[model samples]
Target: YKAFEPQEARRILDKLEIHYTPKHGSWLNMAEIELSILSRQCLDRRIPNQEVLKNEVAAWQDKRNSISKPMEWQFTNQDARVKLKKLYPTIQQ
Candidate 1:
């Protein structure tokens, strides 16, 4: 598909006022880890169809929810400011 023109993209972004994290950032890394775990633990076998896939995922979710534990996210904004400082724009004092 053709990409959006720069002006159009900028206009949309301005309208949405969306906040986005950088690629390979901690949030994205955590999401990738979750998806990898789901794929390995719940979707290791071939799913014959979308219906089967949906049912399988639902069952997996039910089982997971029953035994779910809170995730401990260690990364903090302060940590990001220190470790990923290069990715952020400089602040003027």
Candidate 2:
């Protein structure tokens, strides 16, 4: 189960004895990420009612899924070594 509010979420977590970390930081939460993506792809500069929002989001999701691929995460230590040598700590060469 999940909750949107911190107090309710804490209550549920305590009852379930489960521990989870929110992405980003303590104050920077997942809702911000979701809202940013939704705004850019579906809601930016437009106030579609609930039904239209749902339908448009669904259509956009369908189209995106048809061509979507997994993201490539390539910012490994080696990339950082070359790109940010000054900031990165020395590694075995």
TM-score of each: 0.50, 0.43
In model 1, which regions exceed 4 Å deviation? 1-33, 87-93
- What tens digits encode model 2's per-residue C-alpha lDDT throughout 1-93? 344588887777678854566443443444465457767987776755889878888887787678765334456768878999999777687
lDDT of 1: 0.81
True lDDT of residue 70, candidate 1: 52
User: Candidate 2 at residue 42, lDDT?
Assistant: 75
Native-structure RMSD, model 2: 8.5
Instruction: Indicate the TM-score of model 2.
Output: 0.43
